[model samples]
Target chain A: MSEAIQPRMIDFKPHEIPLEDFDISQRELWSEDLKMAYFERLREEAPVHYCKDSEFGPYWSVTRYADIMEVDSNWQDFSSEPAITIIDPEEDFPLPMFIAMDPPKHDDQRKTVQGSVAPANLKNLESTIRGRVQTVLDELPVGEEFDWVDRVSIELTTQMLATLFDFPFEDRRKLTRWSDVATGGPETGVVETEEQRREELMECLAYFTRLWQERQEQGLSNDFISMLAHGEATKDMSPEEYLGNLILLIVGGNDTTRNSMTGGVLALNENPGEYAKLRNNPGVIPNMVSEIIRWQTPLAHMRRIANRDYELGGQTIKQGDKVIMWYLSGNRDERAIENPNEFIIDRKRARQHLSFGFGPHRCMGNRLAELQLRILWEEIQKRFHMVEVVGEVERVPSNFVHGYTKMPVVLHPL
Target chain B: MPKITYIEHNGTQHEVDAEVGVSVMQAAIDNLVPGIDADCGGECSCATCHVMVKEDWVAKTGSPEEGEESMLDLNPERQGNSRLSCQITVTEELDGLIVDLPEFQF
Candidate 1:
């Protein structure tokens, strides 16, 4: 007798399954083409959904834009203490960053380094970023396929991060690896086990500690490491706190921008008409950058714990209930954005989406992220006629970091 | 191009030509004016670019849109004359506009 064949979960179409059976938290759901289909269905049928059980345990998925805004703004009711992922941070390994803290503490720690990416600082860093971007682009082999994610996005962002920390340039790749390890889980292929993840992150902490001491000896400096070491609020942070904040800065600077960089290329290749529009008028690069970030919607969701009984999206969120605000889903909400699915580079009010998040805990380095993207697009227009995607784009497996692992592309010189 | 004056909270003033059709935030950004953070880059999603329109130019600058107003509400010190510079487009009539920059963008 022939062995019974079982259908693979990835083979199941989202539409084939009943709405009641939908569970968006499954890491497998993020990798399949049905990801968006599931989000679309959730937005239409159950904007505020409850998954009774999943890998990350039962949680409420707020899929609509207005509801997400409510969750983001009402921090008093929805707390971000401990950690901000669907899977709670391990009790043995507590990493406390400012984004996961509440009120006065969050404000104090945030202000410690907010000036680094302030508009004035960004203006100063513009020329340096431009030079680095040019060098990265100029070095790429024209008309030859390469992984744009690694060769361009990761390299450029890692370089910038190294500059921000004043770290040794040759060791810059460690920043990229650390950023990946920080957010990646066992399924992402970046790490095989939770023990391995913790081990790698401890190495990261030790390395940063050495840099912290070195920066302290040099007195105050504009670089992030020195700033944290000197700032009154951040200077005395615990080792765990330091590691948490370092991971925050690394992932914040690395993943979002890098993914959007890859996403932009794929987006343009898929929407050639929009690409034509952008090529016709490179002046639209600034607006198009926002559109790319919006379309990509990196860092898929941020989870918060309900501090008190609260009513949201016509549902009562009981105290201690885990509420996840799916930023990717909200960015694609039909009610919030016009023609949210299609990639439109010239969309008026393009920045109306929620990629950088909203309210007080909104990304501090958002301007820096936008500046990096804007410069890259502006430079791309100058040198390349097109960055042709030559192979299937590989996506990161984790549901948290919605990003590309590899993308083959060949640059076409103008 | 329309000339505009930006008065920082510390009393430093910047006088620059505001490119017609661009937002006030862009003009400040172009001129390196210190206070308009425009962190969301004129998305109307952030109130970092909050400015107090001069009394005479309040009518010309216009009121905030509902979305912009909602974001402005996030600012605890949001005043009657408060306007997100990014939401106010530069026009011929907006020439010689003077706006007071807030002390903190957060």
Candidate 2:
């Protein structure tokens, strides 16, 4: 009989980071080069590893894809009530949204906002989304180098989401800024102090409150806010719940999609041959979109509270414990994916990646995000012959979102 | 075979002959109905195949399961008659059934 490999505690605390300054690139979030190194180590050593006495308090980092899916699917055992992120929610943090709620209530509230992200709704917006993608691509500096992250990816996604919500296009940047402050811990970029984040949160709440009030009074049926304002869920939602959900929708829509765009561009540039494959056969765009999301694995991890004591991957998790589902690691699992390290555009079953998550909490904006990405790739193919990396890509200094802050790309028009 | 009619939110109605064993969602997809994508392949997870049973046929179609009912809450134009079409099998009794596609199903 084969003996079980003796479990060994990997000393990762020598690399422990503050909750605020937890940038993945510093450790490994910057580019695929850095990430692959760390992922390989994690997979080899402790796939379901635990870390103690670090930032965000003591927690388990569930790395393997199968482990993440097991934890995510068994939500009853792995609760979402305590904290949704690695960092414990401060006293001033906004009330929990549906994503943080458990069954029954979570089921009800989630449904209220589901329609806005449903595939049918997304199909209707395809043309407008395509137009927005084209608009962003058209505005790109023809011969000069530009930060695709800011000028192209973020702007294009922000606009698409804004239009879907019927948000005032002029002030849409506020959504991006708030999402950054809300999710941006001290790791990379601007780390908002607790007080500053609270102030920003309150300010955003005030703006949303006014918008909700106006929508209620006007009784318009054109946007998501209006639908939420007059929906069945409104009967039960407190002002805090309403605002918390609005914030979740905006953040959920913004950061992840934005990161996917930036990640896609970086992936293609890094894999020029794959880029050539995509350019040569535009028919591969759909699969390419799946591969990008799989390869990038944006939204690194989602935290879930253990509702009851449960065992996973031979590890015992007590009730009320925290489990971090590392989607980034899962997407690269050697067992689940063939050539998991390589970015193959036509990898069969690439769409099965856990980036958008799986089961009940799967991303509601999946279709819209895919539509925008498809159009963006289509437009880029039409306009540019090659996108050469001109400068260093700046990565967001956080583990939660795998994204680029700046990617200087020289667009060569066809 | 049962005849099913799907009237989109935009008022486009598609009539098709459906076998009793298949689901209304399967029937819609088979006929290339525009709105129902059924991304999850009728698992009731995607909620892409949401449809509002015509008022007269509401009782005949029966209430949705807990999963489908929960999913309907997320539908934008969720009416009292909302049901995940994937969950509703097209039995002989449901012939001439009418379902309205919601304007939005994310």
Candidate 3:
């Protein structure tokens, strides 16, 4: 077992310490307000800040827009192999998914399932997505406050995930459960022990293994599972590899868009003028979709292992050092974006943001994600005057998934 | 609607009508033109929508901006006439525009 590393002891309280001294990796700093403040300070004072120790151990942070782009694009120096999270991979139960892989293999395996999210596929899925979005919105209780994250965001994204894998419709929430377990920590209350998390993920692997067999027997199909079962590169994956890739797709298809869905509501409610502007000009929905992604930054950071010693943004990143690219911070980088703090729906060049990442390993389902958001907002404009934020918002506790856990909202119909 | 021709690297040609104000990338997407990935959904973050503006139309299409150029720089196959379609807004003057999609975009 890898020895559990303890966080470096800090003598001063977080709020009492000056903002410039903040460690961006501290989970407590991830709360919306505190995190934003910390990012603001980093972009101004230290774009490439190094932490001697974190829960994940010593790492360098690329906090500014251009610096992150440099790190993300130069995969030769900063590789994605082994892992992409702050925590090291579980040595006992290593799951080798393509998102954490380097080129050649990563390119091949990613291409295997890339067909499912092609623009052509998105065109076919658009009506189905719209139908589902309308159904969820229509079923929403007007004038009563409810957790939008659960009712709207989770439900809609789960349904889309079910469609992707063609998993049993009734047991679709299993996908959601496994996804949460995959990214969850002990503090999140999703799983108390590593063994428990492993057990649940193994259950997930078993379920998909059955589906894999069924799909192979049925020959080729358009679903993601069938694509993997039939693809030249992925047909013979080991059980662990299969589980790794499945978790990637599930979490990729789920959390990013799901969180963005919730974040869209939160951003709009917080910026009433933007919401009113949206209502007045529904033509901006497509552009606003990109802006929402920028503002939301669903996945907070993607860690890259340095393949060799490298110099970037006035700092040296030694070989094998874990480097974190904070997408949330870069998305708010004033140098890269004008008025980075404000949520402007109609901003020019709205798509120019770091939320989807860049280079070879950028988010595979980016267009589909945008399609879902665009359709949801399109339907929203036709019905609701405003989706009022009615109660306190609870953000996900983890630093990795920058998402809302619960947000009470009431829809005011047009 | 202005008609634009997109030639795939494989020599397959698709002629589609592009709405003014919408992007040429959007026009290709609307027409289901195969090669233009537009993976970032017109973000200009990904150069998946790279197209080589035909020789005759190079002057009309203009050049890629700094952001688009940086994205295109990552594409080894980028040409002198290469433009990120997302950055090029469709307009009446580009009615008969011809853009060749590189094989890599597929």
Candidate 4:
């Protein structure tokens, strides 16, 4: 971690902070869920705002919905290479995942593995997902408070990740640990040091490397490892490349819907009217799923590098400057979404939201994520009157993963 | 007004009066047709609005532009006749056009 001094973003109100000092990258703001007001101010004042200095150094923030659409879609001007988060990826230990690579290279590698999670395969996986969801939900004790984030959210998504990888069912939690460790570091408490973070990631690479070797001997298969091992394009991927892609897949498949699962329960409990809307008409589950994903906006922002100087929102982003497209902020931008702050389940054009990001590099596992959430909610509706939020909910103390660490909830059976 | 028929994968046909110059996607959303998610709200960037034009209507609808083709390239289920409904503008030439909605969007 950079030894740069921490900015006490929470001490200053959103409006009180000077525009130049508006560093939304601060962990305190996201941990406390205090970043929204700051983003609202930025979208209102400076849609293409820049912070001259921060712990991660200087960068620009694109907060408006349409501006994000422009930056995200134009990978030509806004490069995704190097990294896709606010902090620059660790040097010396580079992870060359496709999400961070530009076109041609990005498209080639993503094409090889995207098939495993695309709509065609998702159709086959639906029954398996629903069955696991049933088992996970059925196993939970009703009327007793439990950590929904762990018991339901983590378990369900983790199981889905395992199924997608055809990973060892007994050792599935390792996937969760690796996913957490990949995105987190000493500050978030996943690992005590940056060196340890890299060590665990290498361990992740070794394990997957073994899986790759084991699966390479077998015939072509449906799981990600088998597909990659057998894929014409990915067969000879470097260890770093394999690990980078694995982290991308594991975290991509795990954290997103995991947070959405917990977020939906809290969203419903917070907005009882929406819960009632759900109970009255279960048919709205699909639409509600989109709304929930939008509401959570799980991965808060995607970072990009300006390939060339470009003008957006009347501000000129110079080439080589790091840029952060705040999807969380864009989702709440009033200009695009109607009544952006409210959680309306039946909201029209819910899928048009920025949570998926737009353009070629848009999320590869979006369909799987949606299917998982939709089925999970469908199962929840049939089993319980409410997954009531019964205790203090702890938010993840990081900007990238907008999620809950612990959400105490007690299911009231119908 | 052009009568564009959106045939779902299951053979359910929804024939709606598509307004002149309106995209085929907007007509379905207006008519509350079951298929065609149109997630990007008429931007050809998202391939979710994919639809297969019938052989008879292919000439009238035309081929996808570079942007549309690039997006469709990412979709595994994309067929030779696949065109994003959001990119297909409803016009007099397409009066009797019929397109088949795929089983699911990418």
Candidate 5:
């Protein structure tokens, strides 16, 4: 057994560490050396460390699983208003959705959008979504290498989301780019020029505006956008508000699911025994889906505002203070998950992951996300004998979203 | 058996026999209604069981409790007649109660 390292104070002021020192654009979230170092540090001192200065601002980072659950569940104390990401919007472009709002009004806006993506609606999409996944996989280049992130993961998820909104098929990739710009700006790669980012945002809004107008002119249909366009939520949704909700759904549904697919395949490649176990017992796909979500935890963290002064983990949190719940860390909490680090498919409590988040603001598209993942695995198993990671797996630089930017895999078809 | 009617978001109505003493949410789940998930198992924690009480059946269902009221504050389509299905217990008087499913419940 490794000895537990003693707790020591380490200041994580953002400004103290220059942005250039951290390769935010690199595919590996942390260089392998850094990842191991940080995980070790988290297991020891300051599981709930405070950073004095970050690019966004000073905030508390809740790294433990139990601590994240406590904060996520207790929304009365830790509100979802002001902002939901660690980087303050003023310092960066703001996320326009009301996922950041608090009670009363938050409830109203949520109700409007919830009508379209509820579980029942998701169930109806199962076969359609599954078929779409199969179709995407069926077209893959048999023995050749390709950027799985772009060709498979992004294409499949973006198409599914576009189908959900009844968007034109040819323009679906735009949805992917917009979401990339919206969430990818703060983390790494080409920092989108302010004008380029603005253009993308406007493009997204204009697309939704046109859709809303068409729906209004015609009538409500089966699509989510139509449902939102004519439903109770729209009674008060201004053009901008409608566009904001559309963007929220697109982002919520896109990266998280795409990453899980990429992550699940990558995890299987890394653990061949587990992959063989899955191939032998196809019955374990459902459980395996949950495990992948837990292991990958595509969305790393979500921020909440303290409604009032409260105390947690022996520290006092003033009202309106920012609290960052690291869901990735929470999903691997040693207290909540057994053998937290290992990728165990049959672990009974695997579904109890913070990846979908918890409480009211939990993911709206969780069921759809899971369905897509399960189908992807099922199709992959039927068509391919093996998936080998031919090269290094790249991770997005931003702390908010976690997943590969480029995962080159060579598919071996049976 | 009490007859209850559920009008889905698309205006499709499902009429079924509901047992007395079970909440509307339980009735929907018992009948395998498509939209009512009740993911939190009727704890009023997840707003998945949200239903709109028909105007005529308001008195039979009674007003939402303080907790239900607060919980409803988190729902997106909350209306004047919005009630959490878990909070309402079935009674013979509510045999013909009508409830409408919202278009979305995440």
Candidate 6:
């Protein structure tokens, strides 16, 4: 609320806008929830549309399901280095995390910590996650309106993140604050200035460094700090690199799931049929989790730099062009998904969506995310008849982190 | 049509007839077999369609190529006989093929 985003689009329908004038990367469109119409137009007319100018500069939008798959899977052709968002990496304060790095290094670093959050490992954490979900649900006031985003979504995700990192239980909100600062710039009001953002992040690194040293002195444990401290590939990382990976894990585990949590409740309220379907058959929660992920599309787009001149969707993209794979757009592609806009609780092949991206860079926490959501919904169904939305839902004003800011809700018992 | 037997983790076996050219992943999906989730469709990009060929039938299924190997390598559950079903095309040579589905798809 520090400053209003500069208005870029006039009151014209997305279809009325000239194809050349489409630059869907603007933050205003995301906050206003008007980016979908723009993406719909791009998918129909120009699956691989290029915007000559945008707030983030020139970039090409891969708006189709098949085309996004091609770009995301072909890492040799389109690299993730330098940056993974439309905004270029800060030159002075470069964060060399593996998500933005290409193979060999990316593979090695990812594998070292990957074991902790892998699906096999998640089975052991299921009870712990379920207990936390139950605790959160049990504490909420029945029939009383409250901010669901803060009470349930943020509370549950932050608690789970704390358990994963072995972070301090009382100071868990710091993880939420840090996740926001890492992805958001001063423009979004996470901090007053660029320097303040860096300073807070440094404080985060210093805090984690203490835990890393403590873990290094002990036997290898199951927590993330212990895994990183003992991991051969990650043990030698520099301070900046460690901070980069920390930010990556925090944001990856936090904002994405938090949004989906609120998004699912909102979606269920909006579509009563689906909510009824969920009530009748609680077994559909697992499938509904995938559908919710697709519907939310927590991260709207992942940017890549073309490594060589490649022809995609009948357009020649230069070697140095910035390419954005709009996962939100692809998840709604009618060509790939049947009735892409509707939220069907029992949609077949629900997991086949670009929300996680694909190939090596596909989300490492996909299973962990699913497990949490499954447990939450399963527990929610057992207790509440309906978690009714009571008022206006506010959304986060960033195209990169597609999520909610507030959703007021009240729980009703069966 | 070649006959493919997909054994789920819980010992449930689904024997389905497959077309001559579709993938083993497609066969399971088409037959409504429960375990395999070919998230990438028939593309070798996503290793979600992971399956372990029964020891007796491993040779007939053939080894995974380099691209397929890279995808399978990303999975922590990958075993020595592990393969991406999407990479395995159905054929007469794959008749009576038996593949064991993992407990979970990565």
- List the TM values for chain B, per candidate: 0.97, 0.94, 0.95, 0.97, 0.95, 0.96
TM-score for all predictions? 0.84, 0.78, 0.83, 0.97, 0.77, 0.97
Looking at model 6, the pairs that clash are none
Q: Which candidate would rank higher by TM-score, 2 or 3? A: 3
Counting clashing residue pairs in each candidate, in order, gives 0, 16, 0, 0, 12, 0
Off by over 4 Å in 4: A1-9
Best by lDDT: 6
Displacement of residue B90 (Cα, Å) in model 3 is: 19
lDDT per residue for candidate 3 within A369-390, as digits (tens), equals 9999999999988998989999
The regions of model 5 sitting more than 4 angstroms off are: A1-36, A91-95, B1-106
iRMSD (Å), candidate 4 = 0.9
- DockQ values, each candidate: 0.13, 0.24, 0.13, 0.74, 0.21, 0.72
In Å, residue A285's CA in model 1 sits off its true spot by: 0.5
**Cα lDDT of model 5 by residue, A1-414, tens digit:** 112222223434433454323222122433221343354355355666666655566787777877777787677889887668776764344455668776657666667666556666677888888888788888889889998999889999999988888999999998988888877542254343556766778888888788878977887787877777677755557665665677778888898999998999888888888998998998899889989998988887899888888877877878877888878777777777778888988776466677877666777777677778888888888999987789998777667778778999889997
DockQ of 4: 0.74
User: After superposing candidate 1, which stretches have Cα over 4 Å from the reference?
Assistant: A1-8, B1-45, B53-98, B101-106
Could you tell which candidate, 2 or 3, scores higher by DockQ? 2
Model 1 chain B worst lDDT window (10 residues): B69-78
Could you tell which candidate, 1 or 4, scores higher by lDDT?
4
lDDT of 3: 0.85
Give the DockQ-based CAPRI class for model 4.
medium
State the lDDT of candidate 4 residue by residue for A23-114, as single tens digits. Answer: 98889988888889999999999999999997789999999998898898888888998989998877888888989988778877888888
Model 6 deviation from the true structure expressed as Cα RMSD, one decimal place? 1.5
TM-score of 2: 0.78
Q: Which residue pairs show collisions in model 1? A: none
Chain A TM-score vs. truth, each candidate: 0.96, 0.90, 0.95, 0.98, 0.89, 0.98
Residue A332 in candidate 2, Cα distance off native in Å: 0.3
Q: Give candidate 4's whole-model lDDT.
A: 0.90
lDDT (C-alpha) at residue B35 in model 3: 75
What tens digits encode model 2's per-residue C-alpha lDDT throughout A1-414?
112222223334423433333222233333333555565566656677666545466677787877787787565577777457777766655567888787777776777666666666666788888887777788778788888888987898788668767788999898888788777644443543556666787888888788788888876575778877787865357777776777778878888888888888788888988988887899999888988988877788899988777887777887877778888888888977788989999777566678877556778778777877888888889998987788998877566777878889898988
